[model samples]
Target: MEKITHISVELRDWIVNTMKTGASPEAIANAMIKKGFDPIFAYRTLLKLVNNTPVEVLAREQQPYIYEIPEIGQKGNIIATSDRDIKVLMRVEKPFILYLENLLSEEECDELIALSKNRLKPSRVVDTATGEIKTVPGRTSSGTYYRLSETPLVATIEKRIEELTNFPIENGEGLQVLHYKVGEEYKPHFDYYPASKINENTGGQRIATVLIYLNDVPQGGETIFPKAGVSITPKKGAAAFFHYGNSKGQVDRMSLHSSIPVLKGEKWVATKWLRQSEILERS
Candidate 1:
């Protein structure tokens, strides 16, 4: 017997269940190693299960970033930008999550909320199977999108984002303004286009998401990653950034996230999704 490297379906389910209950990846790996599995195999297996990608696909999609992000500063909290210094509040590795502070000023946040108030409409999501926008059951909110550099404020924000991520402006989508009231929520979902539903007109695959919090919710409204066992509370002028796309074009399942329901005050967010190629601004 050449040491069974294959993870059985039962074992895979157990691994996913354990992760959902808040077990760290390292702990999970240790347990599997004790059960007679290779360390490399154990690590990869956990990643594949958590990401919901096939084992073979996961192995092949372990590719490098197409563009590099500049180094984090000495304390690992400072990110150098052309005009502003973004402070990192926290970081997570498996799904590549970052909690950033002071990415926007209070004045900027208020102005954005004011600008989007009159333009808001019911939020819609892409229908994975059809590639069309539809109002789904899980998401209950309203939103609007600003064309790239549409206003002086929008342009300035976009420029700072470009400097921070090192992703080209041409590859970025419009800034989406979203509003959520008490009892509203967006269910867990991936930011990247599904492997089976890739649409060229939609600008290839979405490589990353940068979300700026416009206002703080008094009680609820947290950006949560169920599989990663992470929840980040909303704070005005703060932001969250995560990347899911790899050179092999496989999406990271650990990037699946959602907005918990607003319990007290409303929540507002401005989101920018970066794609692999240039997407012309229509409006």
Candidate 2:
């Protein structure tokens, strides 16, 4: 008997029906082979059809990211909240980053580190395809998240950020503390996500970040913006704040940044990710 290589319409429909009736691929291939179909072709076709991978659509062309000055940019060198005073150490315009000092205090920094020291776990990223949190090689650090305003210290910091940026505290995600030992680094990446990942319930698309340095690094662990030729050193109680997204849904690709490998000492930092609107609890 001659072996069939190409699948006909009738045969394809039969195969689909057989699979839907709870037949396994191995059993289907055996049946196809008994009917004089090419063994290799039978197995391969069944496998492909079983997986049925979806095709990805091409993204439409987008306009350049429009630059919108953030509230922190308009303020004077000193930003005074009801409880604290933060100083603007430096400002970078191309990507819109602010070097802030005294966002936390010496005592606050130490306390945060101590609180998170034992609770640290390997850092993770949101899986683009599956929408799951997962660990990846690019980010090599241990970190933990604190519930929004969970502690007096956390509440104080959140209040300060709310007053400083004029964005409501409800717009911010839980505070995160990260620890990078020597040689650990977070590879360069954007903070903004693809539109599909933004969930309105957990606030909308992230618009900005307030990454506060909880402790000074003796050497490396600098926040690097490669495109802008900028490197911000980690200082105790200081921070690097960058805004990328705007109301029009435009995002600044120039806000790309990373944590360079800690060449000398351990690095500790607290991070707050801000969204476009108040975060609603998942129902």
Best by lDDT: 2
lDDT of 1 by residue, 163-236 (tens): 88877888899999999999999877767765545556657888789999999899999999998999999999
Global CA lDDT computed for model 2: 0.82
Q: Say what the RMSD of model 1 is.
A: 10.0
Q: What stretches of model 1 exceed 4 Å from their correct place?
A: 1-75, 280-283
Model 2 C-alpha RMSD vs. true structure (Å) is 11.9
**Tens-digit lDDT string for candidate 2 (1-283):** 7787766433453354445433466876776787677999788888877887422222332356788899889988999989788899999988999999999999999998988999999998764323446676778899999998789889988998899998899999999999999999987777877664678888988899999999889999999998899999999999999999987887777787889999998999999999999999732
Clashes of each: 0, 0
Instruction: Give the Cα lDDT of each candidate.
Output: 0.78, 0.82
Off by over 4 Å in 2: 1-60
Model 1: how far is 239 from its true place, Å? 0.4
